[model samples]
Structures are given as structure tokens and as C-alpha cells.
Target: MKGLTIQQMAIGDSATFTKTVSESDVYQFAGITGDFNPAHINEEYAKDTVFKTRIAHGMLSAGFISTVLGTRLPGPGTIYLRQELKFLAPVRIGDTITAKAEITGLVLEKNRVTLRTTCTNQEGVLVVDGEALMSPPKA
Candidate 1:
């Protein structure tokens, strides 16, 4: 991946990426992030939650935004400034998540870009929605 300094992005650019959440992914993320909440691992325990089954962590779904911004839309060296997220629905194992982002604004002086972001599952259910701020490297 090449460096992306704040000159490669435009106000109307966009990107999309997808990934499937597996039991292994949840487990690994739990181990790495130390978020071993039962709802993310124990099926029986998860049944008691509002979701009725084990669900992926909200942050995990949001992580896809980083993947999209850093690797696709702006590509490498993109710096994340801020993000505002809402967990709309549960993400379960076997669910294919498609994350989409559309550039909404470009702060030329600040060298920042704002994006409207959303993540939906294969069932067309939105799992996450948010706004992200990033500084893409100059072209």
C-alpha cells in the first residue's frame, strides 16, 4: 500500500467493502481486544440477550469502516480523525457485512474529509450507521 497524503480525495468520492463474520473472527477479536462478553461467544448465554443469539461486537462492525477508508477509498496512510457510530442491529456469525462510505465534505484548510458510513448485512439489514472523519494523504 502506498501513502495517501491529504490530496487524493474529493468531496464526492466513495467506497465499499465486505467481510463475513465467523465464529473464529469473533473469538480472535475477543482475544485481541479483551472483549470476551458472553454474548459474543456463548450461544446459550447469548439467547438471553435481546438479539436472541451470539452477536459480533459493535466495534468489530465499525472496524470495517477503517478497512474501507484505509485500503480502498483513500487507500493507505489515511488518518482517522473521528467517528460517530450507532449500533442499529446485531451482526451474527455467517452474516456477510457490506460497509459503504460516501464522501460528504472536504475541509481544505484542515485537510480532512467527512464520510457518511453504513454497514448492512446480506439480508439487507443495517447493522451500523455513522459518520467518519479522515485525512487522506496527498496524491
Candidate 2:
């Protein structure tokens, strides 16, 4: 797949990816990661928690940011360098989430790009926020 080189990107350039979280998605993530936290897999057990119901794993939302970077912004062949995330809200099953990434800075000498990343639910509630550093494909 073709990717944007560092020179082809500019500050404020952005992209987004959206998906509806599903029960199957949760289970698959849990199985792959071996994270069976009751808050994610056990609805009955989650009733006792602050969320009052099972919530999708925070990493699942973070993956959406990856999707935007890997498939859209810097596109394919981008090398992820670093990421910092803050979980701002819960993501429940069936919530449609839109993950967005916007170019914030670029280091042309190093072929690096800095991005502001975020994910928002259907209700426009911010669920996740972060920054990412990446190496765009060679020009």
C-alpha cells in the first residue's frame, strides 16, 4: 500500500476511523490478550463497579488510533515510535467510536511526525486522548 512521506504531510492534516464496539469484539480482544478482567467480560460482575456495566477495554479504543495512523494519515509503512494515552470515559458495547489523528508537528530531518489522537463515542463524549510519534514512509 502507498503511504505519505514526511514531506507530503503537513501540520493540521488529519484522518478518522469509526467502528461500533461489539460484544464479539470485546471477547476477541480479551482472548487474544488474555485479559479477562470481569469489567470487560462479566456483565454480572460489572454491576458492582463504578461503570455499573461491562466496559470495553481501554486498549481497544487505543487500537482505533493506530488504525488512523497506519491506514490513513502517515498511511502504510509508518513506523510507530511512541504514544501517550489518557482514558477519559468508558466505551460500552454498541457505542460507535470515531478515532481521529491530526498532524501536530514534523521533524523533516528525522522523517518523524507528531500527532494529536482522540476517540469519541456516538454521543460525542471524548473516550480517549493521546499523542503519537511516528516515522512516515521514506520519500
Count of clashes, each model: 8, 0
True-vs-predicted CA distance for residue 109, candidate 1, Å: 2.0
**How many backbone overlaps does candidate 1 show?**
8
Q: In model 2, where do residues sit more than 4 Å from their true spots?
A: none
TM-score of each: 0.93, 0.99
lDDT agreement with native, every candidate: 0.88, 0.97
Instruction: Output the number of the TM-score-best candidate.
Output: 2
What lDDT does model 1 reach? Answer: 0.88
RMSD of each: 1.5, 0.5
Which stretch of 10 consecutive residues in model 2 shows the poorest summed lDDT? 1-10
lDDT of 2 by residue, 1-139 (tens): 8789998999999999999999999999999999999999999999999999999999999999999999999999999999999999999999999999999999999899999999999999999999999999996
Maximum-lDDT candidate: 2
Residue pairs in candidate 2 whose N, alpha carbon or C atoms collide under 3 angstroms: none
Q: Candidate 1, residues 39-139: lDDT per residue as tens digits?
A: 99999999998989999999999999889988887778788889999999989999999999888988888888889999999999998999999887766
